[model samples]
Target: MAQAAAHTDTQQHPIRLYLVVWGWLFILSACSYLVDYFGLAGYPRWSLILLFMMLKAGLIVAVFMHMAWERLALTYAILVPPLVLMVFVGIMVLEANYTLFSRLAFFVAGS
Candidate 1:
């Protein structure tokens, strides 16, 4: 098990780093709460919320999950499917908008 021992040593699990990351995560969580308390309106609010969410998720994945030191292939395997799904979700949103507009137009014309 010397190989296993050597492999474990390569990953530096410093308490300080964890503390710092935890502090940042806590701050980000507080900021998200502040945004809701302030009643931010419209796209700007959503943009900020999504940005903060992604940042928090990224930090969790990178640090807590230890994906940062992983191989490129493994990293892409874990990340790419969600990215492709997001692309399809965006496309579906556009199609939904078009369908909604058409239905509203047809009903308006009939009335």
Candidate 2:
């Protein structure tokens, strides 16, 4: 049987990947913040603020956190709770919209 090769001394490590991922994450974060800061200008696409925030958060979680490297069960274990909470939040926000707008309308009319 062929023997395995003897282990060599410490191998050279590459810092490029780590630097690139971190740099990309920083850029994404800065861009998202810029969008939010400028959203105060009364632009029509203010919802893009939330979209960019979500995208930046997703990239940070996936890349910096290595969320894509886990098993399916582990991924579900980590992700399902947030998924459930977001669903609940969405439902609550939808429900609250009517109440909020109705109250605002009444307040405006009264004033």
Candidate 3:
């Protein structure tokens, strides 16, 4: 009897929340597909696709994976590392571009 009571006390999320998240996921997926369907190319297309993908992934993690209800420390633990890695990647890309441009400039000027 006590175990049944404890089980009942556990968190129960509403179906509506899951349904709403599913809807948003579908919409985001459609938008991602549309980026390709409309024949978009270059940075704008890639940016929009990446943005939608991130949004959908966030929604799945937060809602479906129940991360949204988790404690702040756990959320940070799960999310922070990937974000930091992305930052490092962006920094490396910048450095690489600078190196490439400098090399090109040096060679062109020398010639």
Could you say which candidate leads in TM-score?
Answer: 3
lDDT (Cα, tens digit) per residue for candidate 2, span 1-111: 233343454344358856876787778778767876766544544566676667777776776677766588988998899999999999999989988999999998899
Q: Return the TM-score for each candidate structure.
A: 0.82, 0.57, 0.89
Q: What is the TM-score (0 to 1) of candidate 1?
A: 0.82
What global local distance difference test value does model 1 have?
0.93
lDDT of 2 at 26: 78
Candidates 1 and 3 compared by lDDT, better number: 3
Which model scores highest in lDDT?
A: 3
lDDT of 3 by residue, 54-80 (tens): 999999999999999999999999999
**What shift in Å separates residue 43 of candidate 2 from its native position after superposition?**
7.8
Q: Model 2: residues >4 Å from true position, as ranges?
A: 1-14, 36-46, 97-111
Task: Tell me the deviation in Å of residue 10 in model 2.
Answer: 13
Worst 10 residues of 1 by lDDT: 5-14
Candidate 3 achieves a global lDDT of 0.96
lDDT of 1 by residue, 1-111 (tens): 999998878646889989999999999999888888999989988988899999999999999998897899999999999999999999999999999999999998899
